[model samples]
Each structure stands twice: as C-alpha cells, then as structure tokens.
Target chain A: MRVGELSRRTGVPVPTIKYYVREGLLPPGELTSPNQASYTDTHERRLRLIRALLDVGGLKVAAIAEVLRAVDDPGRPVHKVLGAATERLGARHAEHDDQEAAEAGAAVGELIERRGWRTDKSSPAAADLARALAAMGRLGHGAFREVLDDYAEAAERVARADLGYVDRKVAVEDLVETTVIGTVLGEAVFNAMRRLAHVDASARLFGTRPEASD
Target chain B: MRVGELSRRTGVPVPTIKYYVREGLLPPGELTSPNQASYTDTHERRLRLIRALLDVGGLKVAAIAEVLRAVDDPGRPVHKVLGAATERLGARHAEHDDQEAAEAGAAVGELIERRGWRTDKSSPAAADLARALAAMGRLGHGAFREVLDDYAEAAERVARADLGYVDRKVAVEDLVETTVIGTVLGEAVFNAMRRLAHVDASARLFGTRPEASD
Candidate 1:
C-alpha cells in the first residue's frame, strides 16, 4: 500500500507518517516511482508502536528512536536489560547532587538488597526508583516508603508473569520488540488497572459506588 | 518568607511561581507591599507538589490545577476515588468512537468483572486501560492481552498496599493531597520497580548481570 493508505488505516496523518519516516522511526517505503512509495504491513506495525510509545508510554522521540534502533539491530542481544526503555520511563531522572538524593539512593539500595534481587543501584530503573522516592520525601510523604516492599514483591510477580507470557507467545526473533512493548505499554496497562483497583478498594472502605464522584 | 525565598527553597524560579499563582495552582502569597508578597511554608510545599506533578507525573498544568482544586475542596470526601488524579494519568486519552475501541472496552469490562472490582466501565481508569489495550492490538501484539489477568492481580495488590499506606500515614485533612500524590507519583514508583524487576528476571533467565548493557 501507499503512504496515504497506511495513514488512513492507522489513523495517522500522511505528513506525520512522513515525518516518522524522516526521523527514521519508520523505515522508508519502497520507491515505486519518482514521486510514489509503497509501505508494507511492517511499516504499519512499526508506526502503531511509535504512536503507542509516544501516547501511552509517554516516551520522547529520541527515546523511541533509541529503542527502535536496538530492535532493528540484528546483533543486539535479547533478554538483556532494555536500557533505552528503562531510561525513557516517566520516573526517569538523574540522581540529584544533594543530601536528600543521597538518602533516597541509600534507601533504594537497601530495597534492592533486601528484595534479594540480583541487580545494581546504578541501573536506569534504580535511578528512576531513587528519583521517585526522593520526590515523595520532598512532598512530605516519606512514610509512603514503607510500601516499597509490597510494591517490589508485586513488581517481581508481574515481571515474572510478563516474561512467562512472552516466553510462551513470542518467538526468539520477536523478543526484542515484544519486550519493549511489554515494558512500555504494559506500564500504561498496569497504571490504569491500579487506578481502577483503587476505586474498588475505596468503594469497599467507604461503602459508596465506585463511580461515586464529586 | 518572601517570593524569592520560596523560589529559593523549592528550586522553582520566581517567574514560574508567579505563573503557577496566576494559574491558580498555587494560592497567591500575602501582599506585604505594592511589589512584594510574603509566602508561608504552605507555599513552599505546594510549589514542590506542583513541580513534582509536572516533572514526575508528567501532568499538564491544567491537570495539576484540577487536582489541586480537588485537594482544596473542603467538601471533597475522603476514602473515595481521586477522580482528578485518575483523569490526569499518563495513560489518559478520550475513548475512541470506533470498533477497535468498543472491543477493547469490552475486554476491560470483562477484566473488571472477573476481578470482582466494583468499578464501572465508564471511569477514566477504565478508558485508559481500553485505549492502551487497543494500542497493543494495533501493534500486532494482541497476544499481549492474555496477560491482562496477571496485570490486574498485581494492580489490585499494589493499589491495596497504596491505600493502606495512605490510611496509616496521612491525616484525614491531608487525604486529598496525599491520595493525589499517591495516585500520580505512586505510578512512577511502581513503573520503575517493574522495570527493575524485569532486569532482574532477565538476568536470572539469561545468566548474566542485571546491569549488563548493550
């Protein structure tokens, strides 16, 4: 199909698709003529992935480009840390150069050690956790850190389940893209469900309908 | 303290503080003179909260304004859904009026029912879930839908832990702000941890260090 058909089918504009092509987020279509190019099903899938990362994962174009580059690299190994995906998460921020950041970093270190998870504190995900924990301290919600254990346990279970799903359903060739999608869009899925679950818990606690509103 | 002191304390610039004040995200400081205003500790905390929501939660200024409005509403009930916070999440998007949306909506409804959650399908969180699910479908990872059950279970666990944290750590008067922070920033914490856990799981499965890079 042509670019126009690809845009119509995916609900993306032609100009936006061209922009993605220009950005190398989507591969250039095969040239059929001097002025015409033909896209494929692969282009459609890649386009949707780009949009999903932008809209749902809240990732920047530079981050998406990094992850996609990893995906398209034939030599890139699978089942390794998806550094780009982790670095691009919403919680991602550099460790602050201050006492508060130092303390948050220590707390994150302790959580990883206590959880018995074989990981280091310098990973992008750890920096993300440290930054978020530090922000909570600034917000005067430092006591909220008590739930870190529970959250980490839940994270492990979900990660295991996520890996299990990909192991069963995704082929080795598709592992990188599947892992990227599962890591990014999967966060959106879990965030939404967590909010929904909050309503249910609140309904149980307050005895009001979950849809009870202001 | 004065505006300069508040800006210094929170690391927010004077112009940004004025902008937030004009936007009603921060209450105006008390006027001490024609050109100067005195701020309180409350101003400092509110500024930090606003910045955290903007930076960590990835919320728009308009959404932060809405959430802060609810936090200030004296009549807003405690232990109910923090609807504004839910509406402002990164996954947030209007439900599309199309066949794909309808199917995703149905899938989300089924998950809610299966989990025995008390929420309805019309909530902001539900719409977020449906949109994310539809995006996954478009990416040709529709098989990813099979993991919804596991994700929902983990969400419920995390949400319950979140409410418990708030119930114990937050005073009744602070419930609204606490809930909003917990909802928005807590998602960041969980997302980061999940990614961290993914790295650990990958390391274990692939027999490598979790921090192994490209």
Candidate 2:
C-alpha cells in the first residue's frame, strides 16, 4: 500500500506519517523510487498501536516510544511494563504511595484530636488508613501519620458515597485511576463545574431559553 | 516577615519565593535595604493559594492567574471562571472527564444502529448517559458526546463500588476528587498492582521477598 492509502485507511495524514517515520516511531516503507514507497500490514498495525497509545492511553511520544520498545522487547516482563506504566500514571501531577496522602490525613487527625474530635474507627480511613500511616512512617514521613490518617478516613468516607453514583458502570481498573485523579482534581472541578452549572441554568432561564411551558 | 520566615510560615522555600517574585506571581516586598526586604501575611496567603492551585488543582500558572483574578473580581460571575477552567481541561484526557466513558456509550449506540449491537436503552450505559452526551453537545465537543457518555456510565459504576470501600472516612468534596483521581490512576494501578501481587506471591512461593524486596 502507498502512504496515501495508509493515510486514507488510518485517517492519519501523510505528513504525520512521514514525521513518525523520521522519529523512528514508524519504519520506512520500501522505496520503489524517490517519491514512491510500499507499506505493509505491519505498518498499519504499528500506526494503530501508536494511535491507541496516544489517543486511548494518552501517552506522550517519548513515553509511547519507550512503551513500544518495552512491549517489543523479548527479555522484558509484561508485568514490569504494566507496573511502570501504572506507577508513571499515578505519579502524574500528584504522588501516589507518597507521604502526602498519609500526611494530609495525619494533620487533619491531630487537629481533630486537639479539638477533641470523637474519633470514628468505623470510618474507612480510621484503621487501615493508620496502616497507610505506618507505611508512611516506615517510609520516613512519620511526623503527621496519625493526623493524616484521620483526614484519610474523612476523605475515604466522602469519596465512597460520591463513588456510589459511578459504581455500576466501569471496570475496577478505570475506577481506581478516575478516583485518584478525580480525588485530586474533582474538588476543583466539582466547585468549578457546580458554579458553571449555576451559570448555565441562570443563563438558560434569564438570557437564552424560553420560559417554562405549562 | 523575612523570606526565611515567610518560607517557614507558608512552607514554601525562599528560593521558590524568589522565583515567584521574579516570575511576577508575587509582588516584591518593600525594600528596607537591598539585602533585606520583608514579606507580609498577604504574601504567605498568596503563596499558599498558588501552591494549592498548582498542586491540588493541577492548574498551569496562566490558568491559575486567570482563576485568581476572576475570584478577586467582583464584576465577573464566578461561574465564568469555572467554565474557563473546565474548558481548559480538554475532553481527550481521561485523567479528568470520562471521555472514554462517553465515547464508549456513543460507540455502542452507533454500533447498535449501524452494525446491530445488542444495546439496551435500559442498560446502565444507555439511559441517563444520554444526558451526559447532551451536556457534551452543549459544550461543543458534540462529536464525542455518545462515546464520552458511555465512558461516564462505566466510570459511574466503578466509582460506586470503590466509594463503598471508603465511604466512612472522607468528606464529600474530598471523596469525589480523590475517587476521580484514584479511580483514574487506580484503574491502571490495580491492574499493575494485581500483576505485582501475583509476582510477589510467586516470589514468596519461590522465596524472593527478603533477598529481592529492596
């Protein structure tokens, strides 16, 4: 197949295909002449894989390159590749498995304790969260363990209820990442979206939409 | 307060404060002398706000600046700021909205109509999910409406289950954001973690933890 045919088939531009070739993300087609080349099924598959990684997985070109290499490497364990990808994702913009979550929990816990908060152990964040704190302590961020544990408990409870709305649809994997990112950005998005919702409703009511029909 | 004191108070470093001042994010202190200028509580508060916007909100500096300006502006509706921020978060990133969720629904719907997929309107991904598609339609990413709604349905289900685990501990807002982020990353994490669990179990069965744990 020609590059144009590949482009037509994949909906990717010929120029972008050329760029991919230049970047070594795609192997060069067999040159029939200076301006003509032949492609193959392998090229189509590679392009599809790249598109999936970029579009579906949202990986950077460099990260995609690394992932492709790992995927193709015979010596590399698929588990390791998966692990690295997950860890990389979790560490995006926010550190997962770091002391921050634990510390945040502990800080709130100590404050609650100082304020004579009736410590609720039945809370999702109470004991196991304290276990996370102990893990943080072993990791050397022990100062705010207890306090962070308390906050973790509070955070856990609220998140659980919020998630109740989403539980019936997604797979377990999608749920976890969405929850993490949602937890991190959802607060901001929630407030922002809520405010925008009010604006949208008001605008529809006062500025755009017709009055309610009886 | 001196830069050192400001650092201690805000938990931001002197170097970072200097960078912020240089970047015009913070107004420079009144110069008592070239060597020593004092910061105020306003500076500390601004720094904390900046950190929260950057760290917790994951906003770029330019976006944060706009948000801060809108927050401070009495004339502007708060919702406009929220909309701007939400819009800045692209629909392609699964880290934020369930673009995949919406897309999946859309895909299924299209498939059912075109290729005769066994889609149920009463199915979790079919009914109210259409509302999400409608919302996305209004948002101008009309092409992605159906697929994104499908993803949302799936995500909503996962969120429900995950939240059930942490409901006793967290606050509503915190829980929502945490779950969103957690589930997004957790999806990836759990898959990886599950594999890791298997690997670790295999290692333990084969006696590899003490020698290879580090």
Candidate 3:
C-alpha cells in the first residue's frame, strides 16, 4: 500500500499525512525506495485514531502525540498512560489562583473528603474542578456549589459504567488506545445526551410538546 | 457606578467591558455627562454572565451575545433559549455527512426512540451525538455503540438531577440565567468529576495507590 491509499482509506489528505509523519504522530512507512514508501494497515488504523482524537477527543496535536508515545511504549504503567490520556483535558480552565480560586479549592477538597474518593489530592481533575468552581464563583454563582455531591454521584455512575465496559470488552493489549477513545469520545457522548435531556425536561415543564408524545 | 467600577467589581478590564457593551453582550451604561457613562447592578451581573459563558462554557463571544439576547427577551420560550445556549457546542465536530455519519445518525435515532426521549428529532444535541459517533466509527470502534445504553442511563440520571436542582433552587424569574449557569458550568463540574472518578477506578484496578488509602 502506498501513501495515497493510506490517505484515501483514512480520508486524510496526502500532505496532512506527511505532516503527521513529520510531527511523529504517525511513524514513517517502510522505505522500499529512496523516494517512495509503502504504508500498511497499522498506518491506516493509526491515522483513524488520530482523526478520532482530533475530531471527537478535541485533544491538541501535542497532547495526542504524548498519548500516542505512551501507547507505543510497552513498559509504561497503566496509571501513567491514563495520566497521559487526561493531561490535556485538565487545563481547559486557567487557574486564576485568586480568592475565588482559594474558596473553590477548599470546596473541592471537602467534596473529595466527603465522598471518600481515593485519588491523588493534587490530581489534575481536582485542580480542574476547583478552577471551574472558581470561575462560577467569579460569576456570583458560588451557591451552585451546593450540588457538588449530586454531580459526584452522577460521575460515579458514569465511571462505573466505563470501568465495566473496559473490563468486559477490551483485550489487555489494547488498554491505552481504548482508554483514550473511551475517555474522550465518551465525554462527548455524555455531554450531548445531557443537553438532550435538558430539552426534554424543559418540554415536560413547559407545554411546548404534547404531554404524552413518545 | 462608572464603567471603571463595574470593571473593578467584575474583574473585567474597562476596555473589555466596553467591548462587551459594544458587542451587545452587555447593555450600555446610561449616558451620564456626555463623555461619561454610568453603569448599574444589572450591568455588573450581565458582565459576570458573559465572562462565565466565555470562560467555563467555552462558548465564543458571538454565541454568548446570541444567548444574552435570548436571555434578555422575556417573550422567548424556554426551549428556544436552551437551543440558543447550546448552539455553539453542537457544531464542535464537522458534520461530514459521510456514510459513517449516516450510520451514526441512525444509531442516535434508535437510542432516542428506545429511551422514549421527548426532544425535537432535528435538535442540535442529537446531531451532535451523531457526529461524535461518526468519529468513533472512523476509528473502527463502532462496537462501542454497544455501551450507548449505559451512557444514556447515566445521562438520564444527570438530567434528572439538573432538573431537580433547577426546580427547587431557583425562582421563576431567574430561569434563563440559572439554565445558562447550570448547563455550562454544571457541564464543567460533571466532566471534571468524571475524570476524577476515572483516576479512582484505575487505582482500584492498578496498584500504584494504596489498596485502602481512605
């Protein structure tokens, strides 16, 4: 298979495929001749993964490169790979570190302690939560913090379902790839559904839709 | 209060505040003395909402302006406002409308039907879900559709909790404002918590953390 076929099969442009190779996102294909190289099925699969992460996972190229490095390495611990997979998502909010941030941090600490959740206290997810809460505080919606426990309960169920899917469906060798897909695309799935649910609930409360229109 | 004081209170710069006013995201302050403008509490609150939507909701400035316009108009229906609030988020992925997208749309239709979800069939969230699934299919993880039911169940729980919070905690007058806060920041809250729960679950499976580190 030539690079053109790889591009055709993956629906990625030829130059974009070359750029990925240069970025080390995709390994260079076998160089059978000085000018032309042949790609394989692995190249096609890797290209698809890159597209999925970009289109759905919303990870930056650098973050995808890092996660791919971990996936390609055999000796990396599962926890370390998991950490890499989530690194980019944690910093979506800038940590302002102001008074509101301090208060938000304390609330996150309290929620974790109350839930007895066993995670690194200084984890990125905790920091992400605090930064988000601080943004809310700045907006005068600090009182919305009252529902952290409820959000945590919903998160717990989501996580449990994720674990069950991972444990039952994937082979041990495919852990890193599966983690990236499940974590990133899975988030998109839930966010869209939550919005749909919001519309449904509103229709129920308001009279825009028929009361029994299934 | 003057524009400077409003900026001081909201932590937005004076120039940025003016930009918001110019963008119609914030109502212009009253004409005070030809060259000066006087702002009020409404300006301050609106400024905060604009900042929150930009920072946490990750919505673009244009989307925020549209949502604010919808929010300011009392004649708007609840569903319409929600539709406006979620307008930007639905287009995160390019709607390729390829074969994979076509299949994904069918899957979303099936899920909505199975759940008896009362939503506009042509809603943005459903399209968003289909786009995400199309990306997954491109990655060769179409089998992941098997877990859509599990994801939907968790989403139902989250929607119920959001509705409960919106119902009991807010006044009728504050419905649109509360919906934006809840829909956007609440999204941040759940996403971060879901990541936290992932770390905890991985700890249970891997041995990097103490088995009983409560």
Candidate 4:
C-alpha cells in the first residue's frame, strides 16, 4: 500500500503521517520509485499503535519514540519493556527536596519496604507518589496517608489482574505492545470507572441524582 | 498584604498572580491607592488552592475558574461542586457516532444499569469511558472490558473511602474544596500507587528487579 492508502485507512492525514515519519515516530515506507513508496501490513499495525498511544495514552511524541524503541528491541526483557512504557506515563518534574517532600519520600520508602516490593526509591513512580503526598500535605490533607493502605490493596488487585491478562499472550513479540496497551489504555479505563463509581457513591451519600447541576 | 507580598507568601510570581487575576482564576486584591492594593488571608488560601489545582490536579485555567465558581456559590450542593471540578478531568473530544463508539456507549449504559448507578449517559465521565473502550476496540483490546467489574469494585471501594473522609470534615465551607482535592490529587495518588504495584507484580512474576534497565 502507498502512503495515501495508509492515510485513508487510518483516517490520519497524509501531512500528519509525514510529520510522524519525520519525527521518527513512524518509519518511512520503502521507496518503489523516485516518487512512490510502499507501506506494509506491519506499517499499518505500527501506525495504529502510534495513534492509540497519541490519542488515548496521551504520550508525547518523544516519549512514544522511546517506548516504541523498547517495543521493537527484541533483546529487551518483557518486564524491561513494560517498565519503559510505564515510565513515560509519569510527568517529568525536578525532584523536590523540601521537608514535606522529604517526609513524603520517607513514607513512600516505608510503604515499599512494608509491602516487600523490590522497586528503587529513586524511580519516577516512587517520586510521583511522594510528590502527590507532599502536595496533599501542603494542602492540609496529610491525613490522606491513612487511606494509602486501601489504595495499595486496590492497586495490587488491579495489577494482578493486569499481569494475569498479559500472561496469556503466547508470542514474545506481542508481549511488549500488549503490555503497553494494557498499562496505558487500561489506566484510562480504570479512571473512568472510578469516576462513575464516585458519582454512584456520592449520590447514595447525599440523596441526590448524579445528573444534578451545580 | 500587597501583590508582591502575596507573591512572596504563595511562591507564585507577581506577574503570574496578576495574570491569574486577569484570567479571573484569582480575585484581584482590593485597591487601596492609585498603585497599591491589599490582599487578605483569603487571597493567600485561594492562591494556594489555585496552585494545587494547576500543579497537582493538572487542571487548566478555565476549568479552575469553573470549579472556583462552584466553590464560591454557597447555593451549590457539595456534590454539584464536586461534579464541576471532576468534569474537567476528562478530555473534551467531539462525541463520536461510529459503530465502535456506539457499542461502547451501550456497554457503558449497561454497566451503569447493572450497577444501579444514577449517572446520566451523557456525563463527561461516561463519555470518557465510551471513548476509552472505543479506542481499545480499535487497538484490538476490546477484551479489556472483561475486567470492568473488577475495576468497578475497586473504584467503589476507593470512592467510599473518599466520601467517608470528606464526611468527617466539620465545616460546610471546607466540603467542596476538600472534595475537589480528594478527587484530583486522589487520582494521582492512586495512579502512582498502581504503577508501583505493577512494578512489584511484574518483578515477582519475572524474577527481575524493578530497578533493572530496559
């Protein structure tokens, strides 16, 4: 297939596809002549994955490039690929050294230790957790830490389900992309459900309909 | 305190504070002279709230304005204020009427009915769920919906805990802002914890250290 057909099939404009190619997010098609290039089924598949990451995962182009690099690297372990993909999901912030952040980091370290988790304290996810806690403390919600255990329990259950789903895949080549999708899009799925549940719970508590206006 | 003092107190720059005033995200300090204005403790608190929404909650200026309007409206119910705040969390996409989106919408509607949730189908959160499911279908991960029940269970548990925390607050004035903080920062906290749990689970399954590089 040619770029035009690829664009038509994917509903992505030709110029955007060219931009993706230029940005190294998508590979260029094979040149059949001076002015014509051919794309393969693999290209179509890659394009769809690219679109999913951009639209649903909300990953930046450079981040997508990094994750795709890990996905395409056959020698990388599946867990490593998964880590690469999940790392991009966190916001990039300069690590804070304030007292609240320090205390929050200590709390995070304790939580990891208590759970017997093997993750490093310096990981971006850990930093994000600490940062969130620090922010909560600043907002006078430091007691929010009391619910951390419940959140952890729920997180563990969801993670187990996620891994179980991923474990059923038979192909090594398919594992990386599948993990990426499950991690990224799965977050979206869970978040939306959480909001729905919140509405349900709030309605029950307040004796109000969910559609009530402000 | 003057604008510069407000800036010094909040760590927000003078110009940024003025910008927020201009954007109506922050109310202007009272004019005391031709060139001087005085802000109050209320200004300091509101400034902090604004920073929390922008930094930790990842809310846009306009969304913050809507939420603040609800917060300032004493006539608004707490749940309504919450709805206003959470409405900004989901992406605002033009609604899709395609087959996959339609099917996903039906699935969302069914899920709501089965769970006895009172939310309208047109709610932003519901629309977000449908959009996510449609994107999953496009990516060949429609089976992700199989875990919807488990996700819902967890969401309910979290939501219950959240409302319980808010219910403990004694001041009616605190309810709306607290709910907003819990909803937004709580999402961040849960997401980070989920990623941490994923790291733990993946490590145990693969016998790899979480800190291992790709």
Candidate 5:
C-alpha cells in the first residue's frame, strides 16, 4: 500500500505520515518508484501501535519511539518495556530545578505512602511526571510539580474509592492498568461525560440547561 | 516590584515573564529605563493567574491570552468566556481526520452522562482537549473513539466508586472540579499508588490477574 492507501486505511494523512517517516518514528515504506512506495501489513500494525502510544497512551513521538524500540527488541524484557511505558503515561512535567522537582515528586510519593497506597517506586506515573517535569524545564516552566501535587491529592481519594468495585473480577495487571488509565484518561473522558450528564440532568430536573456553553 | 520580585513570588522565571510580555499575554510594566522596569501588585496577581491557567489549567499561551482577554473584559459575560474555553478544550485535536476522533469525543461525553457526573461545559478542560486534538491532527495521528470508550467505561466505574468518598463532604462544583482534576492529574498519582497495589495484590492468593486492554 502507498502512503495514500495507508492514510486511507488508518485515517492519517500523507503529510503527517511523511513527517513521521522523517522523524524516524515510522519505518520507510519499500521504494517502488521515484515518487511512489509500498507499505505492508506491518506498517499498518505499526501505525496503529504508534497511534495508541501517542493518542491513547498520550506519549510524545520521541518517547513513543523509545518504547517501540524497546518492545520490538526481543532481547529487551517485556516487563521493562511495559514498565517504561507505564511510567511515561503518568503526569509529566519537564521544566523545573532539580531540587524543587525532586522534592515535589517526593511529596506526592510521601503523600501516597501516608495514605497507605500499596504501590512501588518503579510505578510508571512517578516516572512519567518526573520526566514531564524534566521536559517542562527546557520550555522554561517549573510549577508542574506543585500543580501535580494538587491534582494528585484529589486523585488519591478517587483511586481509593474505585478499588471497591474490583470485587475480585480483574487481574492485578488489568486492575492496575485500568485504574491508572481510568484516573488519567477518565478525567478527560468524564469531564466530557459530565457535560453530557449536566445536559440530561438539567433537562430532567429544570426543563432546561442552556443548550450549550454560553 | 521588579521582575525578580515577581519571579520570586510566582516562581515563574524572569525570562518567561518577559516572553509573556513580548507575547502580549501580560501588559508591560512601568519602564524605569532601557534595561529596567518596575512591576506592581497588579503584575504579580496577573502573573499568578497566568501561571494557574497554564500549570493547573494546561492552557497554551495563545489560548491563555484569549482566556485572559475574556476574563478581564467585564463587559463580556463570564459564561461566554468559559464556554469558549470549554469549546476549545473539547476540540483539542483539530488536525487528525481519524474517524475515531469524533466518536471518542462523543463516547467520552456519553460515559460521563452514564456515570451521573455534573460539570459545567464552560470549564477550561472543555477546550483543552479540543486544542490538544487540533495539535494532534497536525501530527497525522488519530485517537480512536473506541479506545477512549473503553477507557471511559473503566473510568466511569472508578469515578462512580470514588464519588462514594466525597458524596457527602464536598459541594457539587468542588466535587466535579476535584473529580476532573483528580481523574486527569491523579492518573499519574494513582499509577504510583497502584504500582504499590500491584505488589500487594500479587502477594495475595489470587496471583496476577488479566490485563485490561480492551
């Protein structure tokens, strides 16, 4: 398949695909001619995985590339790849003084400890936020650690509550991933849902909520 | 107050503050000379607000400018400004043409509805996702709606459970915002908690459970 076909198949665009190719994030398609090339099923699958790492997993291209490299390398431990990706998924800030950033990161860790959260130091989120803070530093921002703390406190409460639902139905890895994804992605998903909820709730109770945001 | 003073107070860098001034996100201070200018309390406050919007709200400078303009213009209804922000947040992905994008956004909206979440559509997060999606589109990637749907379903269950903790203690506004911030920010926090959970649960008689990909 050509770039256009891949685009059609994946719903991605040619220009963006080219950019990905240029970034070395995606393998170049087989050269069929000067202006045309062909892709394969692997390309499609790779593209899907890339999208998942990016859009769903919310990873940067550079980070996604690293993860893919690790996963594709059979010599690398799968748990290490999974561990790295999980760490990347957490709230990350890249711009902070090392002292403050580390302290702030530790603050959240300590809070979790105090709360009796049963987790490990190798958690993906702690790494994710730690990486994010390091990245935010280059962009000339450093308030992310404190901001993350504020965000974390509220999340702690929610996570504690959500555990009650497992009722032994989920496996540990499944439970952990879903819990992490839910806390992180859930905020985005639920906020959207909350908007919809408002509409229905208001319509049912008051006969109207504004049709949309004013 | 000098730039240094403002920097000390807000914890934002002097250069970034200058960047904000150059970008017209912040008004220029009283010019003392070619190399010097003095700020005031107003500047400090504005800087604080700017930091909050960026760090806590996760807004880009350009979008933050628009938000600040709306926030400052008393003639405009707060609701309108908020609505615009929410709309912007909801439309974060502008460039990707993935068929799954729209469905994911809609699914997120629906999941919140099913979970009985109540939030104002005018919240900053509404536009945050929209802007993110727009940037994502430019990258030639797509976030599938089903992935988000699966995420939302899992999140709803977690949120529903989390809600039980704060149901009686917090106001609706606080509950919703806390939940939103928690879900978003806490994803990382809880990952840390769950990393600990994984170790704890693994020690139990159940052993490791299934992974929840779908």
Candidate 6:
C-alpha cells in the first residue's frame, strides 16, 4: 500500500504520516520509484500503535519516539521496556530536591523497604511518588500516607491481573507492545472506573445521587 | 497581609498569582489603598490549593476556575461538586458514536448494573470508560474487560478510603475541596504505587530484577 492508502485506512492525514516518518516514530516505506513508496502490514500496525499512544496515552512526540525505541530494541529486557513506556505516562517535571521533597523521598525509601520492592530509589516513578507526596504535604494532607498500604494492596491486585493478562499472550514477540498498551490505556480504564466507584461510594455514604443533583 | 506576602508564603510568583486572579481561579485582593491590596488567610489557603491543583492535579486554568466555582457554591450539593471536579480529571474528547463505541458503552452500562453503582451512564466518567474500552478493542485488547471487576474492586477500596478521610474532616465547608484533592492527588499517589508494585510483582513472577536489567 502507498502512503495515501495508509492515510485513508488509518484516518491519519498523509502529511502527518510523513511528519511521523520524519520524526522517526514511523519507518519510511519502501521506495518503488521517485515520489512513490510502498508501506507494509507492519507499517499499518505501527501507525495504529503510534496513534493509540498519541491520542489515548497523551504522550508527546519525543516521548513516543523514546518509547518506540525501547519497544523496537530486542536487546532491552521486558521489564526495562515496560519501565520506559510507563515512565512516559507520568507528568514530566523537573525534580525538586528541596527539604519537603527530600523528606518525601526518604519516606518513599521507607515504603520501598517496607514493601520489599526491588526498584531503585532514583527511578523516575519513585521520584514522581516523592513529588506527589511532597505536594500533598505542602497542602496539609501529609496524613494521606496512612493509606499508602491500602493503595499498595490495590495496586498489587491490579498489577497481578495486568501481568496475568500479558503473560497469556501466545507470542513472546507481542509481549512488550501488549504491556505498553495495557499500562497506558489501562490507566485510563482504572481512572474512569475509580471515578464511577467514587460516585457510587459517595452516594451510598451521603444518601444523595450525583445525577440527581445535576 | 498583602499579595506579596501571599506569593512569598505560597512560593507562587506574583505574576502567576495575578494571572490566577485574572483567570478567576483566585479572587482579587481587597483594595486597602491606591496601588495597595490586602489578601487574607483565605487568600493564602486558596493560593496553595490553586498551585496544588495546577501542579499536581494537572488541571487547566479554565477547568480549575470551574472547579473552584463549584467548590465555592454553597448551594451546590457536595456530590455535585465532586462530580464536577472528578469529571475534569478525564481527557475531554469528542464522543465517538461509532458501533464499537456503542458496544463499549453497552458493556460499561452492564458493568455498572452488575456492580450496582448509583451513577448515570451519561456521566463523563462512564463515557470516558467507554472510550477507553473502545480504544482497547481497536488495539485488539477488547478482552481487557475481563479484568474490569478486579479494577472495580480496587477502585471501591480506594474510594472507600477516600470517603473515610473526607468524612473525618471537621468542617462541612472543607469537604468538597478535600474530595477534589483526594480524587486528583490521590490518583497520582496510587499510580506511582501501582508502578512500584508492578516492579515487585513482575520481579517475583519473572525472577528478574528490573534494576539488574538496567
């Protein structure tokens, strides 16, 4: 197929496809002649993945490029690839090494020790956790840490389910991409579910329906 | 105190504070004299909340303004305020009224019925859930719904913890703000913890350390 057909099939504009090719997010098609190139099934698949990451995952082009590099690199371990994909899902911010952030980082270290997790304290995910906690502390909600264990328990259950689903994939080659989709889109699924549950729980507790108030 | 003091205390720059005021996310200071304005303790608290919502919550200024309006409206029900705040946390996209989206919406409706949740299907959260499921289906992961119950269970646990914390607040006036904070920042906290737990669970399952692979 040519770029025009690819664009028509995927609903992505031709120029955007060319832009993705230019940005190294999508590979260029084989040139049949001057100004004529052919794309394969793999290109179609890759283009869909790129659209999913950009639209639903809300990843920037540069971050998507990094994630794709990790995804395509066979030398990288599965867990490392998963880390690269998941890290990009987080809000990118400069690390604040202030007193509160330091305290929060120490607390995160304690949580890791208590949980016996085998990840590094310097990991971006760990830093994100620290930043969130520090922000909470600044807002006078420092006691939110009291419920960390519950969140961890829930997280463990969700992670188990996630890994179980990924492990069931028949092809080893499909594992990394499946993991990336599960992590990014799965977050959206869980967040929406949480909001629905919040409505249900709040209604049960308050004896008032949210829609009724609307 | 003055606007300068509020800026110093909250660590928000004066120009940004002025921007928030101009955007209606923060109230204007009381004019004490020509070219001099006084901000109260309420101003300080609101400034901190604004910064938290902007930085940690990742809400746009317009959405923050709407949420703040809901929070300030004494006539609005607590559940309504919560619904308003929670709805804004989702990615605001135009609803895809295609067949797959309709099927996904039906599945979400069934999940709500099965779970006995009290929210309407028309809610933004429900629509967001449908959109996520539809996206997953497009990605060949429609079976992701197989794990919805697990995600819902975890969501219920977290929501219960959230409501319990809010219920413990001494002032009725503070309930809405607390719910917004819990919904937004609590999500960041849970996501980080989930990633950490993923590292642990994947390590145990694969017998490989993530950091070792790094």
What's the lDDT for residue A9 in model 1?
84
Task: Itemize residue pairs with steric clashes in candidate 1.
Answer: none
Q: Where is model 3 chain B poorest over a 10-residue stretch in terms of lDDT?
A: B205-214
TM-score of predicted structure 6: 0.94
Q: Model 2: per-residue lDDT, tens digit, A104-209? A: 4564455436533333322222323333333333323344232333232333333333344335444543433233232323232223222222223333323443
**Segments in model 5 whose C-alpha atoms lie over 4 Å from true places:** A30-37, A51-59, A75-78, A89-107, A121-124, A127-211, B8-13, B31-36, B48-58, B75-82, B94-214
The 10 consecutive residues of candidate 5 chain B with the worst lDDT sum are B205-214
Candidate with the greatest DockQ versus the true structure: 1
The window of 10 residues in a row where model 2 chain A has the poorest summed lDDT is A188-197
lDDT of 6 at B88: 69
* lDDT (10s digit) by residue, model 6, range B69-162: 8788887777887888787677776345566788899999999999999998889889888988887777778888888899889998988888
Least well predicted 10-residue stretch by lDDT in candidate 5 chain A: A132-141
Give the TM-scores of the predictions, in the order they appear. 0.94, 0.47, 0.91, 0.94, 0.60, 0.94
TM-score of chain A of 3: 0.93
Score residue B13 of candidate 2 by CA lDDT. 76
DockQ of candidate 1 against the true complex: 0.70
lDDT (Cα, tens digit) per residue for candidate 5, span B45-142? 67765664566345678876765665555554333433444344443342454444464345445644554445443444533444333333322323
Question: What would the per-residue lDDT of candidate 6 be over residues A113-171, giving only the tens digit for each residue?
Answer: 88888887878778788888888787778778778877877888899888887777526
Candidate 4 residue pairs in backbone clash: none
Write down the RMSD of candidate 5 (Cα, Å).
Answer: 8.3
Range of the 10 consecutive residues with the lowest summed lDDT in candidate 2 chain B: B189-198
Taking chain A of candidate 6, what TM-score results?
0.93
Report the CAPRI category for model 5.
incorrect
lDDT of 2 at A95: 33
The digit string of per-residue lDDT tens for model 4 on B1-214 reads 9998888877888999999999998888899999898999988888878887777766778888887887787876666767876776777653446777888888899898988887877888888888888887877777777777777778888888888877774367788788778877888889888898998899999998865553
Q: Candidate 1 lDDT, tens digit per residue, B1-214?
A: 9988897788888998999999999999889899889999998988889988888777889988877877886764564427665665534543456776787889998988888999877887888888888888777777777888888888889988988987778888778888888887898899889988988888787787754554
iRMSD per prediction, in order: 1.9, 13.8, 3.5, 1.8, 9.4, 1.7
Stretches of candidate 2 exceeding 4 Å from the true structure: A11-15, A31-36, A48-58, A75-78, A90-214, B7-24, B27-37, B52-59, B75-81, B91-214
